[model samples]
Target: MSGDVVVPAHNGVRRGRPPQTPEQADEVRARIELATAAVFTEHGSRGLSVARIIERAGISRPTFYRYFGNAEQPLHSLLTLSNEGLVGGIRDALARSFEPVQLGIAIIDAYLEWARGHGPMLRPVFAELHDPASPVSGYREEAFDDIRALVRAKFTELGRPLPSPLDLDTALQTCEYVVYRVSAAAHPGSEPDPADVTEARLTMIRSVLVTLGNRADVERALTVPGIFDERV
Candidate 1:
């Protein structure tokens, strides 16, 4: 009977015995958040379900409501957090100037590191990349939009002829496809192998450079001694 009483939660009714202390409540809230992310990782946005989350979290419906209005809140929060982290480093790198090849390597570096760190969560998030309703779907475009604007500003500041805008956007998208492949990897022995990871990085760099009409420079950069060496 003690555990059956209805209690107020943050946004829903808590059906179980409530936390006796603020710390306990916070702890339960964190557990729910983790569970939400786990569910999101297992199922993309389209497959999200409150029932599954509650089952996964081992909490009653009311207890789940105590912290969230719905199942999507927790994962949305996670996506927001992940988006910041994944894009922040690239923003910083983009703020500074780099040679053409250097820029390619820089973006590749940022992307790979972010993927490795977020690998567990990456697969599901990227699966919905083109899903109009998915939060993750537009993130790549938004980041690319920012990059295009920034490159325009930077090039104008240098008094150089503007590269074709279409080319730039297509190039970025081309490279993004590679990242998506790595991130949304579902097959066994996909990205974990160091060789596959290395090859992906090399391809990303080369694709971007070639698309940008830097074919002459690509060979030189690609040949740079140790350019393909995996970063720790």
Candidate 2:
């Protein structure tokens, strides 16, 4: 009785009470994808079940099946979202930056902002990145390739020298590590400490500057008036 999903259908069948339009279907699918991400992040893949997903999404089994074959179906979408969203954010940030220091900050801000929005979705992605059998096991490398291309182009545009390939690879990894570390420390659904955020951003900025040039570049970027804490 109470567990049954009652829908007043107009034209669609009981098992296919479809949305009025494709956009509505997309909205519903997004909700399920996010709920699946939350489930996976908190409970891992083994705990992923259609029941839990339906409960989290406040939808009937049929409704979920309408958009996804099963609970795990949304995981593929989430993987796409996790990787593409981060790369997309970074690419968009490139347009707003005009110089070396600004580029560093813009990219860092993009990453942290993405991390904040996808806080609950990062854990499952970490698992996927290391799993050899995952269909999208190459997702991380692909996303990195996209990011490196964007960074290389941005650097050339600003007349900045690109680091050796080895250096650039590690440098990009370092920035990602910084974001993951700081984001994990900050609780989702609450404001993080301003001081901690500044510290992490400055760390990313300094790491990039050091990689692009040397101590002189690092000092110059950090010394930009009012751009950083005076004590930093």
Candidate 3:
């Protein structure tokens, strides 16, 4: 039978054929994830439902179920996308730096840029992920592990020893938590003044750098043109 052949609805599956090609399947999944992000941004995860996703994506219930077993699936996809983008940004930034401090600045600058750009979608997604009861917490943990590995690699590349009291894993985790809390605070609909939020982010970056024994990097990062002045 052709891939487009419609299958009968049974066992709670939707009544439609799957996408005919891998590309089509990918497109459908992207559409659903985008719709899911939009819905989650406007209405927190608690408000997200399979019906709302179907309405937003113009897909049927079974189609959604075919692509995702539950409402969290799309959110998980969004989180995965976010994590990939972040890792990509960090890697790109690190490529442009030679010194450890420069690497630190690059990472912070890239993170702040991403946080400001995707704060809306990230806010709700992370809030849900941070919840112990969330079904997709594994995704969050995995993403963090990837980030931690990247950080450790950067430090190793610098050839600079980490502070005596700080292990690589703990320091990376601390930095990650700091970024998470800062991004959460800077999310849209929180602080009214963008300047204040921007300052708060700068402070967050500076504090994290200091915690990592990179105070000089904080100064260099803040001196970068448009790093602090731009409104998120």
Q: Which candidate number has the best TM-score?
A: 2
160-198 in candidate 2: lDDT tens per residue? Answer: 777678988887788777866765666754455778877
lDDT (C-alpha, whole model) for all candidates: 0.71, 0.76, 0.70
- Candidate 3: regions farther than 4 A off: 1-24, 163-194, 214-232
Q: Per TM-score, what order, best first?
A: 2, 1, 3
Question: Taking the tens digit of each residue's C-alpha lDDT, what string does model 3 give over 1-232?
Answer: 6578766679867767553698888998989998898888888777789999999999999889988999877887776777787778877888788876566567777776666667566666556666766644666677667766676677678886644335544544555565566656653766325665566556655555666656566567667775445565
Q: What TM-score does candidate 1 reach?
A: 0.73
Residue 115 lDDT, candidate 2, scale 0-100: 70
Global lDDT of model 3: 0.70
Better of 1 and 2 by TM-score: 2
Off by over 4 Å in 1: 1-29, 156-159, 183-191, 213-223, 226-232
Q: Which tens-of-lDDT digit does each residue in 105-176 have in candidate 1?
A: 776677677777765667776677788888777765676666677667655765555679788877666766
Q: Candidate 1, residue 162: CA error in Å?
A: 4.1
| Whole-model alpha-carbon lDDT for candidate 2 | 0.76
Provide the TM-score for each candidate, comma-separated. 0.73, 0.77, 0.68
